[model samples]
Target chain A: MAEVKKMATRDAYGQALAELGEEHENLVVFEADLAAATKTGVFRKKFPERHFECGIAEGNMMAVAAGASTMGLVPFASSFAMFAAGRAFEQVRNSIGYPHMNVKIGATHGGISVGEDGASHQCCEDFALMRSIPGMVVLCPSDAVEARAAVRAAYEYVGPVYLRFGRLAIPVFHDEGMSFEIGKGETLAEGDDVAIIATGLMVYEALQAAEQLKAGGINARVINMCTIKPLDTELVLKAARECGKIVTAEEHSIIGGLGEAVCAAVAESGIPCKVKRVGVNDEFGHSGPAVPLLKQFGLSAENIAEKAKVLVK
Target chain B: MTYEENMDLQRKAVKVRMGIIEGTHAAKAGHPGGSLSAADMLTYLYFKELNVDPKDPKNPDRDRFVLSKGHTAPGLYAALALRGFFSWEDLKTLRQIGSHLQGHPNMNLTPGVDMSTGSLGQGVSAAAGMALAAKHMGNECRVYTLLGDGEIEEGQVWEAFMLAANYKLDNFVAIIDKNGLQIDGPTAEVMDSGDIAAKLRAFGFEVEEINGHDFDAIEAAFNKAKETKGKPFGIVMHTVKGLGVSYMENSVDWHGKAPNDAEYETAMNELNAKLAKLEAM
Candidate 1:
């Protein structure tokens, strides 16, 4: 058995940023006074001169990142998702997205797993808000390894990118050398009864659900759909055609996260399938322990298996 | 600065004003009052202060200019066209469909523009960022942004000021066109951002105040900005809402309204007469 590691996606983000900073000298980072929490402190330690402490101003930080891009610098602006996506959406839209600047917004503490911070800090609508901006690439990596790879991919791609990360330490499920491509999904398992599509931390639960389903004599396929915008439509349609039942699990709003994206893709492809969405349903999160919140919000492995069973029936 | 140099800048300012009038008149929907007020400063920067080439507009080392108060695109477009970044004929297409001259400054669409800015108080933030980038790269390229006095009412402007000062961005200059009038009324009535110079100074900028329309004062302020180091510079230029045209001068109604046929002709005639006088000098 492989020795699994436990790490927060933000930790992976910081590590990848430090590595990218070494490889690309033109890479710069901007933060809004949450460096230690957001884990940009790691990169700040390595490259103090390249890190800009924007001092609690996300709007200014966003526009500043846009400005740096004009000077040929790939700037990664980091902050909590609530501030980055909610408070500074206009700046991100007009300054970076409209001009199609080469700026990567590394937003951490996304979704309800930011436990104990309550509704003000949790950002479940970021995927939806960012997806609406034209020329913006929205990525939500499922694990530590994938988060690190997503950072590198965003750096290579020349345009506006929003990379969402979480605060809680999730399991590092995948191997280090697994392939990662923007706008592409990776099928982690194959089955015939149903397909379980997931993004961000929910991929782990979806895999667990697949495992539990196997014991019940119902096989389920698990897939990691990282890129929400520019989604991998061909793979999603294939899953719909093959399995005929799709269940999407995410730590975001059911309105516009992986579920809506998968549903839209399936509907646009003229394929009919039974779709089940498992996430925060048009509601805000309350202060609670991370594990309990997952169960309370129906985002746990057990709940996912139950949903799969109902769909399989 | 030499008298000849000042006179040359004066002539260029007149041409820029003419272009602004022509641009707004042709569009039939643009802000001429603020554009005319900002003509001299834009003219001085484009003609003398900025180290930019029309041939290589995207040269990384060139000094960057951001029109933070972007509704005044006519002023920026005129300066760019006169500086040979584009054809002067295209200046008439301001706000027209398919024209590179958008209602606001778009860096992608316009050749000489360094940052895309339309929403108030945002361009200064971007300009400060550019200055920070230049400082990090150990480059000497400077960044300059023009902001409206009324636009200072936005809280984001103060955030940008704080960021600029905190970063110790010496390679940055912010010019405030204190036109005293917004679309609604006098800025004092709308939202009194009391004492613009003092507010910026409190924010840690090495501040200067000058008459925006005076060529000599404009030259001195920019030169002083260049000499000062270790802090960002702010030049609060006292300016009328509309400088060149008689009817539009200090008029709130003219803030964003384009001239009708009769008024357009009168504004053009006035600007041309000023141009003739400067050309004769």
Candidate 2:
């Protein structure tokens, strides 16, 4: 059996994309001067011609990728989340989302965990912008295991997809051979007292929180909600109905993040439940270490456990 | 087929233009002025030059066409309808709620629409993607896109243009409809696009200036485009805003205003005579 190694989801994305490209020759990749940074350099080393370095021009890179998809070749465009979502938003919206191209934007360096590089590089609003785009599928992978699965899943799926990753290395949550399906949520733990829903780097923290709650004799169910756009409403509703209380966590802003998505789903179902959100408040991040930044933004395992305790009570 | 066989295509162009004017007039809301300006180019491509199958709109091997100036979708809808991609009757449904014919081109809803475009700078970028695909696949199929002169002001269009040239997208032909007018006023008065031909040449294109309505000139430009070994080709077609009718030609007021019953009657009268001559010959 392959031992689980802690890795940045961006590394998983790079590894998985290379594997998929070799398996299906139709898969192509373009890096916006972040090949080594995003770790997509792995794919570049294998298929040099297929990998295009657009030289720091994120907008141009996005447009090129969009053009590539129209020719029936699936292009995975990798860049930082802030630039991909902010710099080339109109291109992503008009060319890919509007036309519904099969272009996957694999954005690394998302959320506040883009620590040390500080606030300017961190993108806490990628989900809000991407989820707002019509016909765009948004995926926030929790760990390397899920991130590898997400890249493969996004390639198989059609239309526009934004696969967001972060800078910090996180422990692998799923088994080595676990399967990932787009738009579906995975239930990590089963309980009836409270359900913990989370995505991206926070999902690992969320799982730890569930364990902490269990130690205190309170049952907590954890769900890894990877796809934010199609948003596994069935899974969310089941949590709201069965557990009757919910705690949502993510390394994103409270507004329009995984928390908001779960809220909208729970509200629309008219199934009343005590719901709490653990996320970054309306404040910018400062220079710090990874764990401290997570704690400061209230996206830590301790924060999730506290929120789960409140919601369950 | 010879030139005489392709002459029937001219008739199709007139019918397509008629569809454009009528649809704009019917909706009482569309840019008929620009749509009429690009009628001949659309007709030639859909009828003669481009190898496209209406039945297999998404076939990987088919040539890709993009209307970068998406405001003039009426022109494309008319051409696609005549090419049997959809029904000519569908022209009546333009801009209506639930109609596939949106104000701008939408690839999802409408058949034969290669990319959805409405924002001024977007479609060209999408075409860039299509051409890039042709390069990767080692496919000989070409990519043809049309842009409005007014739309060239958008920064992204230039960004996309540079990519096409930098990549030496020899398989791409970007046709610019220099119709001299746009919404609100004449394009010169609004935002001067100085010397489109020389500008495009500087941007690394095999630039050609032509009378947009001249079929011979259009064909010649396309041939020149085909002959060029490297670098993308750009044709700057000098055209009138409201091209076909006497009253509407070159008039900015007619840019989007649908003709009323009286004006519609006059347009039909002029178009009928033209259609009659085209059908007769």
Candidate 3:
């Protein structure tokens, strides 16, 4: 493989927001004191008039975004995943979700990738919390290119959406030719032995897992399931039919994350395929380096390959 | 602004209180005490303060009102209906299975509701957001929000107040219905807010204390709010828990209970007598 440029998904989010500010006149950005970290500072620097610094109040920011949405403004509210999804869930649910406001929640530093922040800052359950809200679109982009596209797509689509971004610099595997669509899954490769369905940074790991599986004479398919809410059930069912075994990967918890979503879809289809979930198993993450945490929580490419081997067997 | 106008507003407030009784009585479950206490304020806002239209309830440039104390949906619904946003008949259907007038104000379901708010302390932030958006658009639109005395116990309320002040939301006004009573007991006993005016002033608001039920004071406070500049406005209005009904006033039991048939009739009669006396005057 050639040397791929690496960038944080949040960096892409910031660049995309700056670009969006030039396009959409009504596009407003809000931050809760973490604009520099969440990368909304890029938008703030260019469009200070449209950028609102809401201070260190996530609950207030969520409701403020919802209020702005009522007036036909596309408000992108950004904060760490812990504060945006966990601390201010009720505000997001009641203010934005219930009213179906056109506010996009840019939740940065999602999952265990928020390294050295300890368990308190590392939010691995945001996927579960956001997915529980009715009429909330949940999108987790795989790489920087997809993350940038996801930001534009969320602004174009009118409604409440939670776009999760990560802090660690990951490989930019996706090309600009791949069009981003909400609620649609992309099949990266085709195989027959086992299917690896993934989201966020885990999609790259799933692709790597496919390469590893190929060395062991196992043909593993790679599918990037970006939209978690209106999940691509068609691709999931097709994979279950073609490949008799399935493995799901994410940087989140096994409960209520992509793993459970895939399992539920397979079970609903009554497809008798053995499903394995590769994620943080019903536990909290600790303070560590991002790569080591991925390895510790069985979220790495090798770990995904190991899970795929069992499912294939 | 005048004696005759105040009397007219007083009569409208009486009608608003009667609507509150009618709605809660029909629903058989609601927070009547808060609703009754907030009736006069809602009447003043809808009839006099807000720059809105019944024909175009979703007007973008019009001033916005958010019921931060949203359990008082009856009070808000009554005011909206009387303002010709809907029929009085719709207010009676509050909390019913298919009623648009939900137990809490839903902005999508209810016309003229700028923001749907039920969870305490969340609506103020929403109001601040509306005010911010108006400022961003360079429109002269204003935003008003009403909060309960006891509902200030939520930490989010102070957070919202701080933001409104920090952003210098001069177009925003927050009115705290300081009825001094909650569901458990008196607000001072339940959870003493400790000099709400001082606290709000510290939070950078132009604070005013007034009698919430008195039309003159309510009018003065709103007028001052509109004229104020460089800071958010706060009006801590002193009011009775249940303002009109003789038996329910200052009583905690009426905080979240519907009046029985006899109680409802008695309350309506008292309001009717007051209305008749005002008209004769």
Maximum-DockQ candidate: 3
Q: Is candidate 1 or candidate 2 better by DockQ?
A: 1
TM-score of 2: 0.94
Query: lDDT by residue for model 1 over B12-129, one digit each (tens)?
Result: 8888988998899899988989998999999999998999999999888999999999999999999999999999999889999999999998888989988889999899999999
Ranked candidates (DockQ, high to low): 3, 1, 2
Better of 1 and 2 by TM-score: 1
Instruction: Candidate 2: list runs displaced more than 4 Å.
Output: A1-4, B1-10, B277-281
Compose the digit string of candidate 3's lDDT tens values, residues B82-113: 99999999978989999999999998888888
Distance (Å) between predicted and true CA of B137, model 2?
A: 0.7
In angstroms and one decimal each, the interface RMSD of every candidate reads 0.6, 1.6, 0.7
Chain A TM-score per candidate? Answer: 0.98, 0.97, 0.99
Model 3 segments more than 4 A misplaced = none
State candidate 2's DockQ. Answer: 0.59
DockQ for candidate 3, C-alpha atoms:
0.89
Clashing residue pairs for model 1: none
Model 3 lDDT per residue over A1-313, tens place: 6798999999999999999999999999999999899999999999999999988989989999899888778999999999999999999999999999999999999989898998899899999999999999999999999999999999999899999999999999988857999999999989989999999999999999999999999999999999999889999999999997999999999999899999999998998888999988999989999998888888899999998888777
Best by TM-score: 3
Please give the lDDT score for candidate 3: 0.93
* A1-313: candidate 1 lDDT, tens digit per residue: 7867889999999999999999999999999999999999999999998999999889999999899888889999999999999899999999999999999999999999998989999999999999999989999999999999999999999999999999999999889977899999999999979999999999999999999999999999999999988889999999999999999999999997889989998988888798999989999999998878888999888988999999999
Ten-residue region with minimum lDDT total, candidate 1 chain B: B271-280
RMSD in angstroms between candidate 2 and the native structure over all alpha carbons: 2.6
Clashes of each: 0, 3, 0
Model 2 chain B poorest ten-residue lDDT run: B1-10
